[model samples]
Target chain A: MGAVKQTLSLAVEQHARDRLARESEAQLHGMWVVIPAYNEGKMVGEVVANLVTLGLQVVVVDDGSADNTQAVAKSAGAIVLRHVTNRGQGAALQTGIDFVLGQKASVVVTFDADGQHSAEDIPALVATVRDEGADVALGSRFLGKMHGAGLGRTIFLRLSTFVSNRLSGLPLTDSHCGIRAISASALRDLRITQDGMAHASQLLYSIARHRLSWKEVPVTIRYTEYSRAKGQNVTQSLRILFDYFFHRSRGGQP
Target chain B: MIIRAVFLVLLALLTFYVFIQRRRLPFNLIVMSLIVVAAVAFILRPEMSDPIANYLGVGTGADLITYLIQVGLIFATVHYYTKFSTLQSEMTKVVRELALLQHKVERLTETEEQTGVGRDRGRAAS
Candidate 1:
């Protein structure tokens, strides 16, 4: 019994050491931050710089932005991929994911190019995938806090979440939070085909259809004026619905 | 009579062009040809559609034709929209491949330069 306790204690100490070393290990290893940007030059550089300081490789898919998004992202230490034409956020995300996966990224964390999501949440989300065995760790603002979400935005987000849950048949508190960590295995099974804002819904639906294990880690979203200017509104829900019913292929394949 | 001649001529040209593009066009050739044939039949013998129109509870052959054209237009619209969306999705894939390829080449060149410099530095140190 004493020997068993000693072995367990040593295992706990080794786990602590691993957890402490994991940041640099994950950085040198295959943990990648994929930021899909289009006309987000004003914010992407800062976002990329912050993520890079965290010691993770950042890949930014510049979706044919009219601005200097490609230059700014590259200058900020991100491997910039260029789409000669704007293919929307979904396509950009898929592009970045494919690029990073080709680089043999073991885990990919997608963050918005707009400066809304907190960089601090990445470690915990990565832990959920690395240690807790979750195929995906979705960042949920409602599970944590929304710093500047107005009543209208908040209500719309909740409604969107409800609709997404109904459509995808997943009990998620959030649908389009724009920050999630997906294991390389889970990402290999899913592909983002919806080229518009509908990709968010498509992602949730794909997750459900693929039956990947997912956990919602609490993450904060700050609704800055910039983010609000760039974000989705309630009226866009009509277009999103059309995209869901019309754009999403049968069975969520590809 | 002049308007009838103009319509017939235009219809003839349309059918000719459709056959020329039958294999290349993204629409259904058989369906379009059948519609063109039906249109020519109605244009040539207007009274023939009256009986069919009356049986379908439409007021006149002209009204029935108008409704049928609307339905056909709607169907074509739906068909084209889906095709457009598919094209866009396929284009996304092509664009993604091009982007990834560009990135790969750029990285390869960067590494080549870095390694070249590394070799020089190692020689200098030795």
Candidate 2:
């Protein structure tokens, strides 16, 4: 009887896994994940492969990387878009968003290509947009958990969050998480013009400006040695602030 | 007197340059002209800036001239920075368009290859 019970549990687990996979596949139909990669040749392939395994459509905008990021991402099964010259992360994201939206995607999710974000957290973000009817679902690392975040990085992210919250008035805990789910309709009203890391804050300001409904969802970020190395530093944060204020002063348009 | 004449000539050259660049520069033409005129007044009279300087809390015409030049420089810097940023954005848009167009071409080629191969297979099989 005990042996039979173990067999039944194994079959039940397998059935449950299959059902969840099918549900996620159905939910991810008409969904496209946009990953803006700049010289992330070492990591983008694995990241793209993981998403592809999850039955998610992915587009990697290779922002004029000197490395072989284009080839790696292509081999990993991403629809690759290559900018002829180096544009900032914002520009790359815009390119991917435009391409996928043109492909008639119903939902668009901007994900980081540096392998900091986990693929498992993506479904909840999409669900918030699709099922909860939120225009934008922002991934908040503070709301969830993050691993290997040193004290300095933690302080920087929190400080930037405070500043972005004051500037955007959206009451966000983590304003710079790269994972977000934006419905195609909300995207129609949105345009990212910051062309740099400052795009994070600009996206929030945009949400506030358009009066779009947004929900902050818990998402985990693994700050591995690589991501920690490529992560934003104090100088970059200062540049982001300068870009935000300067762009705001210029009326936030090109 | 020679110094003043040199200054006037230099200002004339700058004004001419600004006029020629009127099409490209974001500087307000009228504002730039006004600045050139004021600069000429300061260089010629050398004391006309005193009353204005006093009203503005600047000590003397020479000091006021320095401050005004600095302010003008700052404004020019800001204008050029904005212009540069706009040009960068325009370039980014062009690059983005090129990338998208390239992707479309690739997709078309891919589709053609698959269909062409499938058609050949069907004919061969028959």
Model 2: CAPRI class: medium
Second chain only: TM-score per model?
0.78, 0.68
Tens-digit lDDT string for candidate 1 (A84-131)? 999999999999999888889989999999999999999899889988
Off by over 4 Å in 2: A1-25, B1-9, B15-57, B113-126
Residue A156's C-alpha lDDT in candidate 2? 90
Model 1 chain B poorest ten-residue lDDT run: B21-30
| TM-score, model 1 to reference | 0.87
lDDT of 1 by residue, B1-126 (tens): 677678889999988887887466556777877888888888888888999999999999999999998998999999999788878888999999999889878877789797774557657888
lDDT tens per residue, model 2, A1-254: 99999999999999999999888778778999999999999999999999999889999999999999999999999999999889899999999999999989998999999999999999899999999999999999999999999888889989989988998989998999999999999998789898998888888988998999999999999998998888899898899889989988988731
Task: Estimate, for each residue in B5-119, the C-alpha lDDT of model 2 and write its tens digit.
Answer: 9999999998898789747556578888888888888788988989988999989989988887799899999899989999999999999999999998898778878787455
Chain A TM-score of model 2 comes to 0.90
Instruction: Report, for candidate 1, the interface RMSD.
Output: 0.4
